[model samples]
Target chain A: MVSTARITRQEAEDFLYEEARLLDERDFFPWLDLFTEDAIYWIPIEEHSDPTRATSILWDDAQLRALRVHQLAHERNFAQSPPSRTVHSVTNVQVSPGDADNEAKVRCNLVVYEVRSGDHRQLGLGDLRALPAKCLYVLRYEERWRIAHKKVVLINRHMPLINLSFLI
Target chain B: MATQQATTQRGYAELVEITDKTFRVSSRVYREQEVFEREIAEIFEKTWVYVGHDSEIAQPGDYKTAQIGRYPIILTRDKDGAVYALLNVCRHRANAICRENYGNSQNFRCPYHAWTYRNSGELIGVPDGGRYPEGFSTRGLSLIRVAKVDSYRGLIFASLSADVPELDEHLSPVKEHVDLWADRSIGGEHKVLHPHRYAYLGNWKFQCENGVDGYHPGIVHESAFSTFGEFGIGNFAARDLVKRGSISRGFPGGHSTLEGGARDGRGVGRGLPHRAEEYQARLREVYGDDRAQEIVSNRHTFIFPNVFLFDELVRIIQPIALEYTEVYSHPFWLHGVPDDFNTRRLYEGTRQLSTTGMVNPSDLEMFAANQTGLHARMEWLVLDRGMQREEVAPNGERMGNYSDEVPQRSLYRHWAQVMARTEAGR
Candidate 1:
């Protein structure tokens, strides 16, 4: 149903890679810009959850997104202080048609490595948190491709989750 | 194991050092496996520990897994709606029976030997009953229920030992807080959302202490509070008030509460952020203004051993090892509140308390850091904050300012008594 020609897998990969790079570098504001005004970024504790009915690890509308972005940008955000370092390895980018004429659906695998360390030595923490996940993005082309909805499903969603202080 | 335990018991004096006005807990209490085992037997096994909310297993045949101390059990409701807690282990071959988190089933059949049990935990079917010797007897083969199960306003609690104190007696200190909270549930009750489970790479006691710990927020969670300040909604006397106008009470049996004293309905940790005029009006009409206001006041409570109810959150601490703990947080959705209000509660609950919670990461980090620091050969972990000003209320309850160590000392006092308990000198 996409109005434009079928989106190439490489282009879809580019969208995901850029997003990952921004998150890895803690470039949250620009990363947040990739989302459409009403876009949803969700990480369901249970797969295929209804965000309105069920709880999720991360369920952010644009307003909630702005709040989170503001928190991450705030100089006093200690969780981000000394900041968590993350490296996301994305693979198997796949693209399919979206529900709307301007939309593109993309799915990929993500393995994120995170470490919370530095200057906190007084109380003491150089903790490591790592996990793998599947990310599905519902993209819309408004001038350029922007995220309409994104869901990240962790492989170990059932495991007792540690601090997910960094972006997936 | 017994001899090594004897050696550890001898060090119990060194494990905890207490005075009328000061207390110091050794790092070993957080690091020793023997101490952990003793606590399982002396504290958790002997005391009444909270299991699940009654609403969680409301329907017949509804079941979910729960833990007592370290024993895994299944909390199931039978036909005709009798609630029961059965050990998850199977009778035959000692295998686990129920594997799923929760589901509706009148019977659970063990995959190991196909031993099936009715929802009431009766041994209804055997793979081949005739194959057994005549009258071998399946008399005591039903799933073992916890020793005693009681509830305080739908908050189900179970004691593993028959000698444990009555539920009301154990909850005496915080009974008023519990009853007030339970009554405030919009329709006189609330439902539990699926728990968000997480683990802290620290001892379980840290959670019991930290839930009502008023001293650490300004310093440890400064980043989170400051982050909230950037939003303009958080600077309104939250952290400042936490250090003042507040009183914490220590209960018998290692339980305690931190109660903030503002009765103006503007308290930060009390209720939903929305004006909630309709909700409050209904509450005022039902319970009257004085009672409703008292109920709405926030009470951060530790229900001994491992359960905490703070605001709308119910956190159950599961001790897995000396330095590892798994926690399950059940955010209650009030029955009478608007769906939108419940939705926001769920959203912000995740934001504030879940695995990736804003306020919790720093707290968890501090706990882990403390555990890491305990590796050093330190003599004691200082917990003497505000000991001088601790007051004994007229009712004989131990009281202190919000930012005092009185509650922690209260807990350690109970812990000390439990660790030293012996049935009439053995």
Candidate 2:
């Protein structure tokens, strides 16, 4: 199910990289602009599990995503007082034929090395974490490619996960 | 002054000091390795620790692995359809038999020596049995079953002590609350979905104590509710119910609950999307309007040692070390409910409970700080809030206001009672 028309491999890789860069640099609102209003951001609880019947690590509509972004930017977010810093190394972008026209399923692998430091009250300090996931993106081309649905299947989905308050 | 007890051994009187008027817990209980070890021996081994829901191992040969105070155990259904909890340690060589977290297998073969055992706990193969003596029988070598196993409304529990009380007796105290939560469904049935688990550098008791802690929500999650209020996302009015009007109760055997009233039913009933409305109608049809109203009330339940039914999520807190805890959060889907309604439930469950969840990470930060800060000279942790307002019920449940410390007292008192005994009761 390879998408050979309308978009090229290099274009898709560039989009993924730019998205990762925005997240790494904490350019959230612009990153938020990258998704369509009806976008669904999902991090599945387990690989291949139905988010409708099963819980995902994150299942946010645009409304909840905005709330999340607002929390990260808000001053009183004690969970992010020191704030988590992450570098997303996104790779292996492959475009497949999606179920609809003007939309294609894009697949990529990501490893986000995150560190939470400067925890004076000892809330979250000296903590280094890793988030590895196989991300599936359904991109719809309007003026440019916008994320219609982004589903992240974490490798350590079943393991006890720590906070991912920061965007990845 | 803090008790002079050594950090390696905890005495009964040093850890907890419970009086009729007030209660104080030692910081050592949260920090000391000795108290943690004793807690594992007294609290986890003797109590009816929740293993997994019966629905998790529904089909024959289905299995899931869990831990009980460092003992790796597996809950599996055999071909005959009987549920069993067996220690995952291989009897032949003490190596782990089944390493996978969840799978369907007819037999578990120890990878070290290929000591194969039936999923039913029968030692079916020995790889080479002729090397042993004729009297060295395999009959006594089946995987050791936990001393007791039973279920209360699909919530499975196991005890390492054979003489521990019946599951019904152990669970009778919190059965009503559990029923209230479970009966919200159309069939009084629920299925645990795929779990998201992660470990924090904190004690398991932090999770236990936090389960029924209604007081910290407004203070700790200020940012979360700020946006909730800002976005008009949830029932923002009900967010302050814990601080203003609510009830925290303590039951026998260390079980406790924070009945934060019918105000914040967003996670359960309303203040949600269109799907919840239809779901509520279906629930009302099954349970009538009044009973449905009662069922959908938001509740925080801590079932003694291991389980916490927090809102729509079932969290299992496993203590791996003195300062490390692994928590597994499982969202439940009610049977016969509409797909959209369950979808909303799953969405709300993850938004608050997952690793990247806004609410949980805040609580985890406090717990981590609490664990880290206990090494200070200020050793006594005060749990004296709302102590004088206790109203005891006929069933021995002590009730207090929303911000009351009744749960902490109840939990620590029971912990003291359990640790006071040197051996598991017969």
Candidate 3:
């Protein structure tokens, strides 16, 4: 049985806002640290399907994620110049129960508006799965919740996405 | 200003009869709404436009939505793995039935009303079927199917006109090129790596022109070539080394192919260094020496209207508007080639020509700028480049040098023929 202490909606919203801030600020290293070591970051090429068999815009495990971060910081990446600026808004936060070990799943809707090299793009209505949208970081007294998985399903998943240089 | 105005007026007249000798198309073709509408009806509707590959929707119940000219189409694979292209609008209200881009579903339920359709496009369920007044039969309410759906070696294409020529007849001379890529995939099964699709602010013709325009490599892509040259990497400056006389240019119907030495005969070293040995090995394994050598060292071919089949992958150009075009760059695996070989091809294609590629950005920049420039002035743009060297072929068609505007001229000549025929019929 899991502990019944549920996180408030306000706390979940704040956590999402902070995550978006980190991404918008281009603080990648810290932002990456938010994910657990075994976490999967996915952006499906097709909507409502398994990413394993089909092609996906992004199906990054830790290694792939690291490689993307490395490439973004690399000098030879021509598209990175005039780096993309983004503002992510998380709304409609809802918490649901997870499968195992006192894990609580949180789902929220997200809209990320990004601008790069004079092109403005809107990525709307994505689902984010976090153990707890808010981070407690408990030292000793209680166990803290952190993100175990973050899957973003965009409304226009099949649309030809331009260079996704910046994190959403 | 008066002379310029007169020139513009004359240019519009001149554009209506573009020939094989002309290189620059008249701005009217790209801007005139009348021409755009005619093209949609006559050319797109009459021709076999590539929709998607067979591998995209492999299993039963898998479907993808695509646009053909102005009409939305749903390409789905049935339980038996047969592909079908159906009009996306619901039979009831003409509302799009499958709103999502792609998914696996036993049936498609329209969000507007509860009207449902099976993946095979059958009218499966209708909410409150009894509510229909009297003679409404669910049996006759199926989705409108495209006139013809045909596959050429796994690449599927559909036409709105039933009177259009058969797929093989329309493909005509370009069938060899299609086979070259598709045959490499085992049993004619080629899946797209979910191409890097993006829209460029240019006419679709620009992309077709760019596909066979060998002359632009040394100029428009100077930055990319120069970067490679500076790094002392591949023979980026080998343009002069390629045997100009060895370049082969031919037209099969509206389609054209240009096979020549890359970078002036600097040889088959333009691709990624890591995959060089594997590619050569695979080539040798498949076609032995001579054919593999030809495939590796040659330039690209343009399958008229909008398909570009290069060494590694194919790009299908979908015209969205007069000033905007969407290109889907799909990478395919060559049959019998190692998985590593396909990966290398995918990597090279993605890094160089995909939406986010280094060279593609520059190409898009030039295309956008060209579109902007065309709309800038009222003066006639010259399509007369290399007209002096055009030679009349035995078939009455004209031909030009490898770097000449022969192909573009051929394309527009066909375009005019098709448009004129449609107008005459009307």
Best by lDDT: 2
lDDT, model 3, position A33? 71
Candidate 2 vs candidate 3, DockQ winner: 2
In model 1, pairs of residues that clash are none
Between prediction 1 and prediction 3, the one with superior DockQ is 1
Segments of candidate 1 deviating more than 4 angstroms: A1-6, A73-82, A117-129, B1-14, B235-238, B264-275, B423-426
The full ranking of all candidates by lDDT, starting with the best, is 2, 1, 3
- DockQ-derived CAPRI band for the predicted complex in model 2: medium
- Each model's TM-score? 0.93, 0.94, 0.72
Give me the displacement of residue B380 in model 1, in angstroms. Answer: 1.7
Model 1, span B222-315: residue lDDT tens: 6566656666643434566665487777876788888766665542232355545666677799999998887777678888888888666789
Candidate 3 Cα misplacement greater than 4 A, ranges: A1-157, A161-168, B1-24, B186-188, B241-252, B260-288, B377-379, B390-400
Better of 2 and 3 by lDDT: 2
Weakest ten-residue segment in model 1 chain B by summed lDDT: B266-275
Of candidates 3 and 2, the better by TM-score: 2
Task: Give model 2's TM-score for chain A to 2 decimal places.
Answer: 0.92
